[model samples]
Target: MTQPNDGPPQGGFGAPQDPPPGGFGAPTPPPADPLGKQPPAASPIPPPPGGYGSPPTPPPPGGYGAPQAAPPGQPPQNPAYGYPQAPPPGQPPTQPGYGFPQGQQPPTQPGYGFPQAPPPGGPGMAPQQGYGYPTAPMQPQYPGPQQGGGKKFTTQMQIIVAAAVAVVLIVGGGIFYASSGSDEKGKQGEASSAGTGGEAKGGEGAGLDGGTEKAPADTKSKVGFQLPHPKVTDTTTVHGSWVTDKAYVKTGVYEIVGYDLAKGTKLWSVPLTGQLCAASRHMSKDYKTAIAFQDGKPSAEDKYPSCTQIGALDLATGKLMWSKSVTSAASGDEPIRFGEVTLSGTTVAAGGTSGGAAFNLANGAELWKPKADANNCYDMGYGGGDALAVVRKCGTYDNRQLTIQALNPSTGAPLSSYDMPPGVEYASIVSTKPLVVAADVGDTAGDGSSISDFFSIDAATGKLIVRISADADKYAGDCGSTEVEQCGSLAVGNNKLYVPTEEHDGGGEFGDTNEIVAFDLTTGKLVGGRADAGDDYTLTPLRMDGSNVIAYKQPPYDKGGQVVSIDGSTFEETVLMVNPDDEAIRDAETSFSFDYAEFIYEKGRLFISEKMVSEPRDPSNSLDDKQYLVVSFTTV
Candidate 1:
């Protein structure tokens, strides 16, 4: 299905971007076979419910062999688009960590949807429906023609059918669903959280003054690791706040901040980054010895944000263990960015904005770097271990072609690669079972709006394990587009794959009715009918705890968002509060919308960020003010 020659494109979740509007700049392969190549995916992810037309296209093995051990030369540096320079040597590198979840916050109802949110209670603003693209000015007069195909509905047209509808609890522009959990878990298996951090004053995020600047999620979400409350204007690694007692670290911003549930102080504010720095500029996760996320991206250049230095500092003292740069020779003058610099055991696996590299985090030494076709490789996220998933141009949907690389996270040795889905600029989402989830658009005819078929690739060996399709027509009716915008977040947790879709015809950028659906990892069958999020819903895939999956969604039509809990067995729903004052907030009938949606079930909470969308720019007001929503829910 690699009609890479397909039409228009669309497509980031976080960290970096591919070649800009024009042609993709040439890329450099890792020196010394930098990242070792990986086994190719043997199969393709099955098309979603409404199966798509084509299958995935497995890209060839790593184009370039690991680069030869470079001569003792200085690491390459990036030319700045515009930013401060790094400190001289003997100085710490920059820190990178925009850990905050992106999403708009709540405000007094002015008849407008969520607006510039303050810390707790910001200023009052007029509420009016914001800018949105409406396809059908008035609902199409003719009834949808009866049609049937194997493809699951992209999002069936307004069916004349109805579920148990009710006066959904609406308060403070938040929609409250009759959230209920399994009898076994009681209310424990409920929705999201901000993180392992203290709460900010409600009005702390008043800096932005426009509407919500929301973009679809990047493919870097964890299997329930809720992010922190992030801001809209966050340029550098805008790492948002975590839940109470949870700790998160950053490299460029080079600071690890989180709340110590036991102590309650600003847990540990280790000074990882020095003065001038950028976010996600440089950093790596040290999940082996201590539960710390480290950074060294302050020294990252604009182009290569992910290209960074490394230092296993004393979690307590922030003292350096051994500082070394994760450098690569320049193939072309193109700069690079990075996904979360992952540290498995002590090895570091990072996807340079342009490509990716793996190094021995223990000695600050380079292990291996994988080479890519010039301008072929783009940003990729890790699925733990020696596996890295990436994307690029393909069939339709900007040809969101995702390729999974099972490399030696330490030596960058070639393990295997996955068969890539045929599409453009797609992302490889984080997976728990050495699997890679991707957005694959099949033969989309009418418009490039809806996604035909979304795929899930096996990371171990590039192969198609399952295909979640929304490709063809249905007896109910035809769906809207072949884009994944229908689903807010796509992730896997608690042995279940979670996908949330939004159908906002005239609501806003990603506005529409929200639906959160879960699928069995082994089998592509859905857990239950997608949980309804009302007219519009935003979804966040959360981490998993015992037998349950944590997730959250935002309700459209002036409805605040709420967290949800799904019973692995029963697929029940429970609403939790990411923001504190849960009982009080619920009493006040507060709701929310998240920019970055994901749950950190490992820590029992959900995280979200609020940012202002600029591209599909708002007509009336420019979404300036952005706030974050962080909450946690537990099994009853």
Candidate 2:
């Protein structure tokens, strides 16, 4: 089903562009390869004036990197972001916690989906001394269509359907679903304190903290280990991560490697003939998963071979159980190359332009294969988890139609299907069970975020539950333009959707702030409570910890990032781990761009890894650039 060859657009996909018309934070492009060789993503946002790496105006007490005792009688210098500073004389020192007291009224703030007067430096001014990059609207860079045969499809459209199968794998991969017997054993302590040396809070079951990893008596965390970026002549996809009680596994060049979970010691490696192209975000209950890879090693003449091989992998042992490809009359009976693969129950489902198919996870038994159709329909991709769902395409290229269906995990049969509204070219399945789908209806979001409305559907009945209109400029969530299951920075739980508000002016003169707010699934209206990120920190929903929401707070340049558990009912935050303010540690922790990186926080461990890796931008200083593949921190 090779579509006709349409011309590639100028600048190619992911090329950097001017900031969006208004200075709202734009959807960050996926990480580009080193330098400007591959399609370059927007520049690493400029650091705030006098931000990290700046000439210290007063030179934080002990300089940077490590903390030192304060001079006799002088106030503490560069207090870690969450801990409190000394209060004014006579005003009893406030508790040394990162957030306000429970039920305390939050101060009036701006940037809640509405406009307000710009801060001192005007809109989009980078924060001062913040730990992470602040987001603002940048011009959206939509990939142009690539025509083949007689059909035309946007590059991102192909990517949407093509990469859909990996959604569940990414979401469920080792972080959330990987089997860990020790998780339960670790969930015995109360929330950790804010300061590195402080005592733990004295409350039991205070909030539904995420994962079973018990917080340390002191909440401060130190670097566990950091893996350096592998040298690559060109951009390479290394987008897989998994965690187990004993090991932390990730994809590498032409192989998969497993390392000791707590210690970064290499344990095992599974070799492959070609590089990995896609990986399922979900892991099987038995510590198994699926992946797609090229058939042969790349060469100068044929750099990227067809991603025709699908295989099952045993994460515990780094074993690839099986590998094979499928064929359909749609491609004149030749082996069909797949773009994405996912696992649901005991079945492995993969989709591409040739159509879709499923196989038995345990034995590699073909349960179904693609078939040629008159309408030129094809299975674009699938979202697999609590259930299996597909985004099926139909009709001619000019008037394409799309249907989303919840499928029978074993048979590939549609149990229910919902037709997308007219003119909608692509849709992302945010969650399979609740049937939440996101789309940029009428292409109105205009921020390259690839989302405008979130449709909540009844998977059992294929009926719409509610349509939530998400104003792109005001919210921070990304259902990538190219994948149905590649949405991030948002979480769904407790029959509600949690999303971050775009960064806006904090009443303070030097920094910005944001909050995580929930929307009721049934009513599509704003929920009353919000978890504020405090000043100079950006909050994002990571996942659900039963009824609580696990979130990450991007730190201001001088401080370290934080992970917290927000009570779903009260929206109160419990500090889980506050990274040390050691300058070197802060830099390493924030190096991975949140936009294209994968963060798995389980059992007091925060693993930040890149989905793509590239050679150093300055080859001459390749040895000094110090690029990183994975940077891990833990509180245990």
Per-model TM values vs. the true structure:
0.48, 0.70
Give per-residue CA lDDT, model 1, range 1-636, as digits (tens). Answer: 111123221111132223212221122221232111122112333322212222112112211111123236744332221122376999843311011111242233211111212324445632222111001111111122211111221112211110100001000001111111112112221222110000111111121322121212231222222233332222433333333224433222335555433232344564553311212211233332111222223232422122234345444334456644443443343223333444455665554333455555556576665454443443344434223333323222343455555555556554656555443333434342435343424333111223334344454455555544331221011221221111224434444555543221212223333345555444444554445454334444443434444455543334334555555456566554333333433322222223222223323333333221112223366443222233333321
Q: Write the per-residue lDDT of candidate 2 for residues 1-636, one digit (tens) a residue.
A: 442121111111121111112222223353331111111114322222111111101112211122245578886544433345579999855433222222332232221222223337776853221111122323333322211000112224434432333331121110000111112211221212110000000111122434454457989998988888888876677877877777888888889999877888899999998878778877777889888887777666655466778899999777889999877776564566666787787888887656678888888899998775767677878887667999987876457678999999888889988888765667887777566788766554544556666777777777766666565545667775645677778777666777776554443434556678776666655666678887667788777666677788888778998999888768988999999999788778877767668888878888888888766567467454457888898887
TM-score of model number 2: 0.70
lDDT minimum window of 10 residues, candidate 2: 194-203
Per-residue lDDT, model 1, residue 281, is: 14
Lowest lDDT sum, 10 consecutive residues, model 1, at: 164-173
Model 2 regions more than 4 Å off:
1-214, 619-625
Work out how many backbone clashes candidate 1 has: 201
Sequence-dependent TM-score of model 1: 0.48
RMSD of 2: 14.4
